[model samples]
Target: MRILCIGDVTSPKGVEHLRQNLWRVRKENGIDFCIVNAENAALITGASVNDAETLLSSGADCLTGGNHTLRNRSVYTYLDDSEYMLRPINFGEGTPGHGYTVLDCNGYKIMVINAMGNINIEPVLDSPYSYIDRVLEREAGKYDFAVLDIHAEATGEKAAIGYAYDGKISVIFGTHTHVPTCDEIILPRGTGYISDIGMCGESGGVLGMNPELVVKAQRSRMPIRFEAASGAPRATGVIFELNESTGKVTSIKRIAF
Candidate 1:
């Protein structure tokens, strides 16, 4: 089976760009399951119901999220209502949506989990390692394969998760930096790992935000209204093949189009 892990979608432009190109990417790459992070889908804050619907209807099989997922209060209902969408698992028990979703496709049961790191993030959550440990104890055996999308700032934490789970999870990819990392490798235990998958928005902008806004905020040390760039939007992600019987990752190829 082939799985595609998409990076963050920063704004409306990102959403529209994906809608226009995602289907073709899926076909060209022979993707069986696709996961997209749409945390910054709502103009650099959070995603909306319409944004999630557009992404799902386009090509995303399951939608994963990061820290900005709950920024939009209007989408709170959709967060609770949609099974295809997910927030961070370490957000704990009372969160509106599930942190992981179990998807059944073509007779294969695949588990996709979303998580956030706390080193440089807010509302300090529980340890992602501990949360995933509990999740595995309860649900890992029942699924044929597992994918962990760790939206984090520190590379060490992301690497730690990959090594901790190793053969336990088929694939582990990081998000939130909006910059694609060069390290894409299959661990010694057959798990696919990448430091970050990059974003699906403007390739010319500063992490999907307009360069002007980012510069203003950085130079002035004041809050600047950040907005998504209107440059040529591009798609970024990774495609990997996994074994059916053992549920181990066999190969991985990065996709940037």
Candidate 2:
């Protein structure tokens, strides 16, 4: 079985690009299931119901979130109700929505967990290490395979998560940092891992935001209205081929367009 995990979608164009190319991408790549990090699917940051719906209807089976998950309160209700959408598990204990979701693909139960690293992030959540451990312990033996989207800033933190859960999970794909890393590899125990899968947005922009706006803010040291870039949009991610019977990763391939 093959599952595709997309990086963060920064804006509407990013989501649209995925909508336009996902079907072909999935078919050509033999992807049976898809997970997308859409924390920034609205504009510069945060998710919107419309964008999330577009992503789901187009191709993604599950959506992951990060620090920006609650930026748009309008989608909180949707998040709570959607079985395919998830917020960082470490968020406030009473936060709406789920931290992980189990969805079906060809009659196979696949569990997808969304977690955020606490290094420089907000909302002062619990340690991803502990929370993820709890989740894995509780959800053990309940799914055919498990995949994690570790939305984080520091590569070390992401790597730590991957290593900590190496043999215990099927795949651990990183997100949050929009720049793609070249560290895609399979762990000794068959878990697929990547430091960061980059993002689905304008390749020409700064982390998918208009370069001009970002540059002005950097140069002026003041807040600026950073807009989503309109330059050529692209989707970046990794496709994992799992050994169905064993429920372990057989191969990991990086994807970008």
Candidate 3:
């Protein structure tokens, strides 16, 4: 089975870009299932209900979130009701949405987990290592394969999780950094791993935001509302081919444009 996981979508243009191209990308790549990180899809901060609906209708089989996911409170209800939308699992109790979901792909159950690393991240919650252990144990025998999107800043933290869960998960990919790493590889234990899958947004800016605005904020140390860049948007992600019976990744390939 083949699965594709996309990085964060920064703005409306990023969402539109996916609306226009994702279906074709899926078709051309023969992707069986797709997961997209869209916490920033509404604007530059948080996604709204419309953004979620648009991404779902466009092509994503599931949507994942990061630290900025709940910034817009408008999506709370949809997050609870939608079986395919996820928030960081370690957000602790009483959070709006779930951190993981089990998607039925034909007869196979694919479990998708979203987790955040605490280092230099806000509202720090449970340790991803411990929370994931609890989750894996609680959900045991419930899924045929597992995949995790570790939303984090530090590359070391992402790498640690990848190594810790190498044999336990089918794929482990990092997000939130918005910069693609060329180190896509099949781990020693067969899990497909990448430090970061990059992002889907305007390409000619600083992490999808307007460069000028970002520079202004940095230079002035003031509260500046950065806007999405106007350059052509592109989608970046990685595809994992897993052995159906073993649930181990057979190959990993990075995709962009």
Candidate 4:
């Protein structure tokens, strides 16, 4: 099975770019399933209902989220209603949406999990370790393969989690930092891992935000509203090829264009 995991979408431009190009990427790559992190798909914060819908229609089989997912109240309902749109699993009970989902496709049951790191993040949640442990235990024997999207700010934390679940999960990709890492490898246990997949927005901006605005805010030591950089956007991510019999990744490839 070939799964394509996309990075964070930082703005409407990013969303539009995906709408225009993602289908072709999936087709050319022979993607069996596609996951996209879209917490920042709005102008500067959480994805709206329309943004989520646009991405889903454009080719994203499932959508994962991060810290900014709840920034917009308007999407709360959609998050609850959509079976494949997820927030952090450790967000606890009563959260708008779920953190994991099992999709039945191509004669296989694929489980996708979304979790957030506790380090250097707000509203400190439960340990990602414990939450994922519980989910895997509870869902054992129900799914054929599992993939994780760890929305985290710390590379070390992401790497630790990836190693911890190396043999258990088929693929583990990090998000939230919006900068693609060069390190993409299949662990000794056969799990595919990457520190980050990068963002789908202006390639020249500061993590997708207008560089000048970010600089002004930092230099002036004041809160300045950051806007998405205006220009052509690029999509960045990784594709993992898994062996159906072993439920382990056979290879990993980075994609950026």
Candidate 5:
């Protein structure tokens, strides 16, 4: 199975780029399933339902999020209704949205799991490591492959999770930092891993926010509202091939264009 995992779509501009380019990219690459992170799609703190629909239309089969998942109050309602959207699995047992989703890509059942990092982030339900172990145990032998999106800030934490799940999962990609890491390799166990896939937005800006505003906030140490950078957009992601029978990754490559 071929899967394309995109990094965070930081803003509407990033979303627009995906809308314009995703289909062609998928077709040219022969991708079977696509996943995107949409935690920062909203103009403000909360995202719009239209954001989710736009990503789906852009060829993403499933959408996942991190701490910003609940920024938009409307997301609470949509989480209950949508099967393709997932919040962090460690957000507790009663979390509105699911933490993992299984979809049929061609004849293979692919499982996608979303987990959040606790270091320097808000306190959530449970530890991400424990949560993932539980999910993998329950879903073992039920799916053809499994992919995890470990949205986190600390690179150490992300790398730890990647190593821990090396053989068990097909692919483990990180997000949230919005800066693409050069590390891209398949683990000894056949799982593909990267520290971060980066963000799809203004490459010239700070992360995906306007550089001027971010500079001001840093220099002045005052509260300043950050806005998405407006300029030539760049898309960032990774593509991987998973073996159906063994549920392991065969090869993985990074894509930034």
Candidate 6:
């Protein structure tokens, strides 16, 4: 199956760019599913319901999130009701939304799992690695393919998880750093792995934030409000082809537009 996995959508501009370009990209690439990260969208611009809707309208089948998933209270209501939206699985047993979602595209059943890293991130109920194993154990042969979104800070931790689940899962893409990594290759076990998919927002700014404010805060060592960068926005992601028979990745490529 052809799947498009986008990195974090940080601001409204990123959403707009996706809305404008995603449909065409999907058609041209023969993409069957599109998964995007939306954790930083709301945090970068307060509340971004429009951004979320735009992403879905643009062709994203599902949206995943990380530490900033709960930054906006409005998303709480949506998370409770939207099946297409997911948060980290390690958020404890009573979390509102599901950490993973299963979707039927044509005749293929695709399972998308979202997990947050523990290193330098907020404390959660359980370790993501263990959580992923539990989920996979319960739904192993039930799905045609399994995709994982590892929202993390440390590249080592992300790489470890990808390798740990190497042959078990189809694709494992990292997020949270907003900087795309050079490593994009299929694991020995046939799983597609990328250290990071990067962010879809301002390319000139520092990790999608306004450079001026970031520089001021760093120079003065004072708390300052960060704003989304304003300029020509870009989109970043990865495309993966999975083998239906073995539930492994056949090939993977990075996408930057």
Please give the ranking of all candidate structures by lDDT, highest first, separated by commas: 4, 3, 1, 2, 5, 6
List TM-score per model, in order.
Answer: 0.97, 0.97, 0.98, 0.98, 0.95, 0.95
Report how far off residue 112 is in candidate 5 (Å). 0.4
Q: Which ten residues in a row have the lowest lDDT in candidate 6?
A: 42-51
Candidate 3's residue-wise lDDT over 80-130, tens digit each?
Answer: 998899999999788998999999997899999999999887868678998
TM-score of 1: 0.97
Global lDDT scores for all candidate models: 0.89, 0.89, 0.92, 0.93, 0.87, 0.86
lDDT of 1 by residue, 1-257 (tens): 99998999988888999999999999988899999999998876789999999999999999999888988888888888888999999996777888888998679988999999888877688889888888888994688899999999999889988899899999999999998998989998999999999998876788988899899999999978988776899878998799988878999899898
Model 1 bad stretches (over 4 Å): none
Candidate 1 lDDT for residue 178: 90
Tens digit of per-residue lDDT, candidate 5, span 57-121: 88999999888888788888898888888888898766678899888889888889999988877
Q: Kindly list the per-residue Cα lDDT of model 6 for residues 1-257, writing each as its tens digit.
A: 88999989888778878888999999989998999998777545333566678788889999999888877777777777877888898897666678998888869989999999988776544679889989999997788888999999999999999899998878999998999998998888899999899988877899998899999999999989888887789988999988778878888888889
Better of 1 and 5 by TM-score: 1
Off-target runs (Cα >4 Å) in candidate 5 are 44-46, 123-125
Which is the better candidate, 4 or 6, if ranked by lDDT? 4
**Model 6 shows how many backbone clashes?**
0
* Candidate 3 ranges with C-alpha deviation above 4 Å: none
Which order, best to worst by TM-score?
3, 4, 1, 2, 5, 6
Q: Point out the worst 10-residue segment of candidate 1 by lDDT.
A: 118-127
Q: Pick the winner on lDDT between candidates 1 and 6.
A: 1
TM-score of 2: 0.97
Which is the leading candidate under lDDT? 4
